[model samples]
Target chain A: MTFPESNLRRKKLGQALMFGLARAISYGIVAILLLILFFIVKQGIGVVNWRFLTAMPENGMTQGGIFPAIVGTLYLVAGSMLFAFPVGVMAGIYVNEYAKEGPVKRFVKMMTNNLAGVPSIIFGLFGMALFVNELNFGASILAGSLTLGLLALPIVIRTTEEALKSVDDTFRQASYALGGSKLYTVRKVVLPIALPNILTGLILAVGRVSGETAPILFTVAAYFLPKLPGSVFDQCMALPYHLYVISTSGTQIEASRPMAYGTAFVLVVIVLIVNILATLLRNYFGKKVKMN
Target chain B: MRLRRFTEPVFESLIKISGYSTGFIVLLIVIFLFKEGISFFNLSPVDEGSSLWVHNSNPVKKLTAPQIKDIFDQKITNWKALGGNDQPISLCTLDELGEAFTEEQLGAKFERLPACIDSYIDSLPGTIGFFPDKQTANALKNAQPVQVDKVSFSKFISGTEWFPTSRPAASMGVMPLLLGTLLVSFFAILFALPLGLAAAVYLAEIADERVRRILKPVIELLAGIPSVVYGFFGLVVIVPLVQSTFNLPVGETALAGSIVLAIMALPTIITVSEDALRTTPRAMKEASLALGASQWQTIRKVVVPYAASGITAAAILGIGRAIGETMAALMVTGNSAIMPRSLLQPVRTIPATIAAELGEAPFGGLHFKALFALGCILFIITLIINFLVERVSAKRVR
Candidate 1:
């Protein structure tokens, strides 16, 4: 089809308009989201003073500084990574290296996608019924860890799978030609290449769990937590839940509402810091491998 | 040969195991939700002596087992039996917005109510129906709420306080709570959907690749944000903005909830619809322009039509986000279970109902079961919409 002279100008204008809609909407959304983050960080970071974090929330303003929550969130993140990463990464390896386009492999892919979409509150309910109450752990850190672990499993799998998908086939071919087994090639070559991407995914997942309040609301996170968690079985406070209480149900310290912002600011900083650290590690290792 | 015999079988079997296990775990979540959620349908004889149902305990220690039974059974149908000579006791239920109604007001069907047969027996105590044990549920029994002299039970159901667990006759029901959830979600959807759609429509129809990349990630990060932080922003900023703007008595009105939910759902709508528009074929835009259509005209017509199904999916997804969101809604919505019709009024939604109260609810208790039942309802609705969205979006060639 031949285009008329008028058509070209009109089409270009139409394209710009179309593109502008996306541009404007995206910019607006970004601006608001940034505002949200900026607000939280501005209000919250001041309260996350080193002493406040190290010590408990005092004089009602503190909301019991998120020291225990930081530790609890860390513990939960570590525990979840420990629980899910190996299984998720291994599953990715199996899916990429071994499983052909068979029904079993297909089913695994479907499961991974569905797992990603299940709203986390459902996870909370399931955890409450099965892990916390049924497993008789009560509202302990262990239950929270396991539930959060399950939440992250889908992320780990999907990201690791994508990373593996991007790996070149020549590496596998060379490894096999050298009489290396599939396992040896994957362990040595495929995994190392995909490590950065996989780690990035894991970090993102941890960031998500660290900030979530719903799953642990019923599974863990007690309000009015008098003493700190001495063990894994005891219920502990979390920054997210603490923020919820301070904002929603706080009968005390209505004036110290900024503490919630302080908590959020710290949360965002922690996420950004982890992301930066992960990026550095990835970059450092990436450079090292290239040099080698 | 030895390696083949052991390694081949062992390694292959292990791969098979993990692949199958992941599928099983996903299935396990669905199965778990359906199983617990479905258990609510197995209604048994509340009339007692029926072996089909197990005898559950009355969780409220303030009332004895018999009292709990009498109250739920509504054997005492009027206030006169409880030392007041007036007012009829009605079977009441708090809707998600904590809107309550007695049988007389609701007017309608079910298994025969117990106290109704006794004919408003004056000797019998006034009893309220519906499960009330969890902190969010209303105190129908021994709920000594402000005694209104109204002849009907609907007036009492509309009152403010909603303590499900309280001393005799002094009680609080979640009328304000139900209202709070609805008001918040309503306001949230009001703010979120239009703004989200406008942005999504814009991004999908017009943005350059470089701008799209930066903007898309920023929006996605909005999705990645933990909601507790949103709650903080709402409490600190949005609350003040609303109070100052409206000059209303309370800052934590439905308007705050709308603002928060609107922000949260923005990314989903934009991402989905933008992807939809992006995938619209270059050929279509070319054809539209050949007709001398303005770029704006071409977009308003051809490009948008191409992405219509995707836009619908985005809207549904936004709606899902709005409906299912709990923490932000709960935190900002003032948690008052009152009946509110206006967007400015405080209201609560079903998800908030479960989140705000499920913690204190004992397993197998009436309140617990009711919340679980609500979960089931939410799951079914969301799952159906999700399924439809997935189906249509998948067919979208982009």
Candidate 2:
């Protein structure tokens, strides 16, 4: 072959090799993800029984169930949502709908992004300082919820803004033309359209909050609280923290390995379910929006 | 109509308040961090209600906390080493004084303990005693109090030891933990960036639409996995793998931590860089192709350059996550608070140190404040990363 022809042939071979390498790497990532899931399920499935879900841990968390921890996590999820949802949605609305294009809007957006990037452990520190010490909540559920709420706030606000922005501008303008007020236009027209996407965001936030261990490490998270917490003022055992303690720091770490796997399985299942739900909700609503 | 008007205005005002509070909350975080963290430097490193006393003839009048730690740790064994008299230093604590005297002679309520401690210190020429202030209030005839220097920011940042609960003084040096954090995060980015960028290239350019649809949500789910679970997986899987593979005594090395963090960071890097690559205008690629460049050549020469800033932002954000990551690092990185010399050795990151140690540090105490200082350090590091991300991605927008 001529030199030029051979060079073109070599370039074609290089392109083919690069494309193949890219495809391999992409598939390799997917395979690793699948392997993680498979490993967790295989190790943990045997330990997770009906009783394990219902009964409290026994024998220093090496035996019995993680009922109290599951309940505690549920309470936290509820409490955090109560604090974050309304405020985040409102802030998102104010930025996306009411606020004009200006530095103020830019500042709020910037702060939200910065807030989203702050480490979870820093949130834990601030929560401990503000809620547990300054506010004298004393490492209770209330303190943890507020901390997780703060941690989840940016996610909620960003999603709410995106959801609200997706609603057509024509909807708002038409509502105003029919003699509706700004608040009424948002409430009656934009919100209805945006609600599903916003719900998806909230679900994703739930997934994020429920799996958080750092923010709750100091704010709350008792190592082994077999019984349920009496009230919001009481510290509670959470799934993520429970798994961490049993696996790493418990008295019989070697013996409690199965229980650690069990707890990890439960936490992963909750987060994955929440994530899958959010994805389904987003896809369903996304299609609906397109249809309209 | 009046009711609607009242409610509308009330709701609007409420949202407006919430909107403004986002910025306010970020400010509050900084303020509270400084409020708690800055106080660490103001406090003495010596334990409260305790004092260190050396022989009256000793030339060393004052020593820093770290020096005291070194003396106690026996890393500094001779008094001459610390600019004092040439004698072998002996360490004494309040409990050791109790060992020298009987309970009957010391009195039931330890009322006679003070005199016994004073006499004990007087007998030993090379002894440095750490005891309660109340014990030596009226009885320091032979022993002189060694004034401990206050904790300084320079010492705290540059000091190597991290024995926070060590007696005579707590070494709140951040260098080891900081180095460990930087080392693990650096390796994580080193491992993650290339693979993530490659996968992103596949998803953005080479993948068919159906494959992209399947992979996108999977990657999102991967991102949604909690750090704790990742830690557990690392503990059960990667730790042992590393241990056995390298023929090491234990597996929870910095390498294991880096592997876990790299996996955890992959989805974020891939997703962000994919978006950046997708933003490379189609016309740019077409022009390159029309110039007789192959698809791979066009991507490398055109798409990658166009999206370089976005890729940098992704790498920085990944670094931020790896640095700030707590539980995974805590579980798998051996929690050994030492300077990491190699990836094969166990190391602890700042976040892991805080998470593991904060539970035990008494609230409002020096150890607690030191952990908070570590938190402040972590916060500043992440903030800089975020600022860089904003700058890089903002350049992309322009």
Model 1 chain A worst lDDT window (10 residues): A57-66
What is candidate 1's local distance difference test score?
Answer: 0.66
> Would you estimate the TM-scores of all the predictions?
0.75, 0.97
What docking grade applies to model 1? acceptable
Model 2 segments more than 4 A misplaced? A1-3, B99-118
Residue A135 Cα positional deviation in candidate 2, in Å, after optimal superposition? 1.1
lDDT of each: 0.66, 0.92
Which runs in model 1 stand beyond 4 Å of their true positions? A1-25, A60-64, A224-228, A274-292, B1-12, B41-190, B197-210, B283-291, B337-340
lDDT (Cα, tens digit) per residue for candidate 2, span A96-131 = 998999999999999999999999999999999999
Q: Each prediction's DockQ?
A: 0.43, 0.85
Candidate 1, residues B138-248: lDDT per residue as tens digits? 222233222112111232234454443332222333355545554565556667666676676666555566766666666766677787777777877888888899988
**Which CAPRI tier for candidate 2?**
high
Against the true structure, whose TM-score is highest?
2
Instruction: State the fnat of model 1.
Output: 0.48
Instruction: State each model's TM-score restricted to chain B.
Output: 0.65, 0.96
